[model samples]
Target: MTGHFLSFEGIDGSGKSTQARMLADHLRQAGRDVVLTREPGGSAGAEEIRRLVLEGDPDKWSAETEILLFTAARRDHLEKTVWPALEDGKVVICDRFADSTRLYQGITRGDLRGVVDRLHDQMIACEPDLTFVIDMDPAMGLARAKGRQGTEERFEDFGLGLQERMREGFLNLAHEFADRCVVVDGARAIDAVAADVARITMDRLSPDAASA
Candidate 1:
């Protein structure tokens, strides 16, 4: 219960991957036992699911189906890797978690409230000690995402309107989990944003502000 489980969230356009790694690197430098991993991944089984869900160009899976895939991978990740890492007292840094399901599936899905409620209540109860939601525009996010290596996956390429709704969903999530989540401006320079993230994480991890 005293271990730190931190998660990073944002739309595809948001620079969470960069910031998450930056934060992890910063934590490592400070001598913290950090475990950096991402969701829909982080294990062999989950990686296969990630490939199918993200890389496969499929129009068959509905929103609910996608949500189910994510949670399945999530449950595997928790049981096989994340939970063990936490028990070992490592500060776990996850790129995405159940939140993505709510944003991508809930907001844009046909049954928004229902999808959100089910996942919130039934699936993910072990909320992170801290969750940083990097906020940015969908158009800009897709552009930034495109700049990353390789071609856009099915999810990354989902249009700007979908991205906007995803952003709104994360914002609402932030409001709902204000004590643990803080929306950091991701539109800024990558290094500047990284610095802010590091600062926030460091402050929270500091002995004097351990409960932060």
Candidate 2:
């Protein structure tokens, strides 16, 4: 049996996590088996890595070092969480995936995208079957993120400038991977955005659509 792998990507506080949960709940209500997860920590080992990367100062690790750390976590996550679910024909919804690394540690610091790509190809050569890129204004995203007052504010502490660049990067990725990436407008009400996501995902999950 095979399963679908879906990922949500966007600048921080774009509401991707909420949407991920909503989608999981929707799928479950529809009687579909679903596994919801996230990164830079999904599995046990990766969760430990998550704190190291997400709780420190903004300068805790260079972008290059971050790339390695993220890749390591991703490999562990796939082995311990994602792969097993997919093997069981369970729909796997991940809050963030390699694309986040491709941006956060790739171009945000400098032009280390090549390094990120190479490392990913070598150690974590997997991609979600479909990706939801929640598009939002950088200023709004940062403000919402700060309002959360979470300890994992290392990335948020980078300021609005980082979010702006990451926004552009995510948009560019939608074009680059148009086949599997769908950009969802995230400025609307929660129900509205969730409705759109459910409609789109249901269509993708349809038997005819899958067979096509």
Candidate 3:
């Protein structure tokens, strides 16, 4: 874990994916090695699992089943993609990680947060060095997510109510993991949000960070 691991999280359509990519690009331009990946699907095996979890009907899988699938995918991702990159001291910017699971499948449908945590500790014990929780209004975020017209709309198809709950869940998660979490308002212009992310990341990467 010599390299920095970063993750972006938010309710659906919170522009976290975009910010993750922007931060990766920013780091790359500064001559740092960057590996931008996303979870539920970062490696080959994980990508296959991603389609299973992200596509199809909203009820295709139970919350319990989804947790298993996500944890398995995360395990594969770490073995095949994340660990190797980190071993090489590359910046790994992930679009989503275990946090998303802790929300989407954990608290949203039931009181499975404990289950998710236990499985995460047992199977995928990785957490980002830094996490950016993008904050956005649920309704607006849902609209943006729907606008994508992508097949990965299974979660979005869960509708506005789910998004609303997820928003609150993510905000609370930021507090729970405050040391490594930074909540960024995502309602602003893309460049503005990106700029803030870049600055924050650079500050964290600075040699003085430990002192600061």
Candidate 4:
């Protein structure tokens, strides 16, 4: 049996990582083999790139340079982690993926959507079988992100306005990729959001659906 690829995406503090873990745990309990990973640090090489891109001065790299670095990390992640796990029939649950690049870089850099898309098509052309975009208000999300302590404060440091733009970008992506993307209300309680994620994931991974 082939495995399913699912990714969780959202603003900085929309609880996407927690939900991704929850779904992976839930599926594992249900007897499915699950590979819970994240980008742009899923593989060894990617992790190094992650530090360069994430733990620096916000302006450490130019917009174009940042995009190139992200794409390189993604390529390493796919080659070393994601593709191998999928080929081995393990359900792959990623905390974030290429869509993060699309939204973050697309919003921060001017007129870079075309570059992002072209890079994706040429280098990283795969999408998750299902994507859960946890929707929430930028204000609330920023507040939550501010509570976190990490050197990865580069993207989180974008503040509320950028977060708002990112929210819109993600929502647009959900609509654009309606077949594989689902927007979940992330403002609710953690358990509530987890329940929704699990249910939707099971629906897609069910035997009948799988054989469809």
> After superposing candidate 3, which stretches have Cα over 4 Å from the reference?
208-212
Q: What is residue 211's positional error in candidate 3, in angstroms?
A: 16
Determine which window of 10 residues in candidate 1 has minimal summed lDDT.
203-212
TM-score for all models, in order of appearance: 0.90, 0.96, 0.96, 0.95
Worst 10 residues of 2 by lDDT: 203-212
Model 1, total clashes: 1
Whole-structure CA lDDT of model 4: 0.88
| Cα lDDT of model 4 by residue, 32-106, tens digit | 788999988999999999999988677788778888999999999999999998888888999999899988886
In model 2, pairs of residues that clash are none
Q: What is the C-alpha lDDT profile of model 2 across 1-212, one tens digit per residue? A: 38889999999999999999999988888778889999998899999999999997899899888898999999999999999998988889999999999899898899999999899889987889889999999999999999999899999999999999999999999999998899999999999999999888877665522321
Query: How many clashes does each candidate structure show, in the order listed?
Result: 1, 0, 0, 0
What are the runs in model 1 whose C-alpha is more than 4 Å off?
149-152, 205-212
Q: What would the TM-score be for candidate 3 when compared with the true structure?
A: 0.96
The positional error of residue 154 in candidate 2, measured at the CA in angstroms, is 0.3
lDDT for 170 (candidate 3): 94
Count of clashing pairs, candidate 2: 0
